[model samples]
Target: MAHRKVGFGLRGIGHAVVNGVGRLGYASRFFLMILIGSGASFRRIHLTIREIYFTGVMSLIIILVSGLFVGMVLGLQGYETLQKYGSESALGSLVALSLVRELGPVLAALLFASRAGSAITAEIGLMKATEQIAAMEMMAVDPISRVVAPRFWAGVTSMPLLAAMFSAVGVFGGYLVGVVFIGVDVGSFWSQMEAAVDFRQDIVNGVIKSVVFGIAVTAIALFEGYDAPPTAEGVSHATTRTVVTSALVVLGLDFILTVFMFRGV
Candidate 1:
């Protein structure tokens, strides 16, 4: 009995590994197809706009509020620590660096994954489970063009906007804490930020990172959802996997981007 149980467990593990790899392969191929088809379906502008309105603009409140608090905390902590070393005047530079280089993009991606990724995963999974995708196929409608394209564009377009909002709010939050609570000189703070950071490279890097993160999130969510097993339980599993996997991918990508952006300097 013990031997049989052990063998069964090993078989289960192997099965899971194989299934996981197969799902990943399917997702990769599906993403490529969608990417190709997206360009060909130029007449779907209205659908794309609707997707942007729903997925991007609707998620603004959470990103802005979270960013504000994060910046306030970072500024307060950084200011207090720097005060001991007489570097408090560098608070603006510190805040700007944190926002532009790390916090802004990372936080926005996390929020986007949680808010938009899960929704897309669940929606697609449900459609798959209910055979809605099949019905669309039967009706001669390409689901990739109708479903995946809009989401892909929405994710890519929204990411930059969300990242910009995060960076702006974070900087404003830091300024509020520095001036109103920490007693920092407003002019000195602004001067330090202006002198220390290059807006061009920082902004460009942030926007680029946002676009990458958006694509990743949408791709992962759609892949998980479209490949979900044919059951309600499968839909739930897909949603969970979408959130977890997207979050991990975002973090991993952030590290890669950071290394590339700051490799020599």
Candidate 2:
């Protein structure tokens, strides 16, 4: 019994270490490819533009609607709390700060992970299983450039734009709640918000975080999809892993950005 327990413990530790190292190695290689321009092809750029249009722009409607509701809820809740403290005038600043500094990027990343990450994973996994990737390689084509580069750049490029859109819609939502629903003065709300929030740092941080998240999501999805086993079950597993891992990475990056942005504030 003692020997068996010792062996199990050792095996578990080894598994954990291996998984950690693998993830780190994957991230390093993905970044290195981008840095070294390992796969620069005209076909890749065209495909990437198509993907950007689909994954980024096509996703705007859902993101906007979701942002509107989130902002409305935040304003409503913040108003109620501030009312209790007789600081109702602070609602605009609160909403703007929250949306521009954190919620906008994080929420958009989550939405993108669900919409784009899953699609990329499924598409690539299908290609892998159907032997399309193999066929391309057999034709002396670089699959990374043809397949992965476009999706990776699309994600990185779209994330910041999506974050900005989310912020704009969220601000409008808060405006509606404050002026129409809560009967707060429009001028006062805007003035207070402008006074309280620093657009340079706060908004910039949000946009930067979105780009980083994009890179993480696209890389994870592509890596998992490319490495998927040659089976239907493997494709399904890759899809799930892509979504879950992207979501976790988005949240983790959010935390890191928050810490760095507000470290001394």
Each model's lDDT comes to: 0.88, 0.86
Q: Which residue ranges in model 1 land beyond 4 Å of their true spot?
A: 1-13
Model 2, TM vs. native: 0.93
Query: In candidate 2, which residue pairs clash?
Result: none
Candidate 1, run of 10 with poorest lDDT: 37-46
| lDDT of candidate 2 over 139-200, digit per residue (tens) | 99878777777778888889899988998899999989987898888887899999998867
Q: Which residue pairs in candidate 1 have backbone atoms (N, alpha carbon, C) closer than 3 angstroms, thus clashing?
A: none
On a 0 to 100 scale, what is the lDDT of residue 50 in model 1? 86
The deviation in Å at residue 195 for candidate 2 is 0.8
Model 1 RMSD, rounded to 1 decimal: 1.8
* Residues forming the 10-long window of minimal summed lDDT in candidate 2: 35-44
Each model's backbone clash number: 0, 0
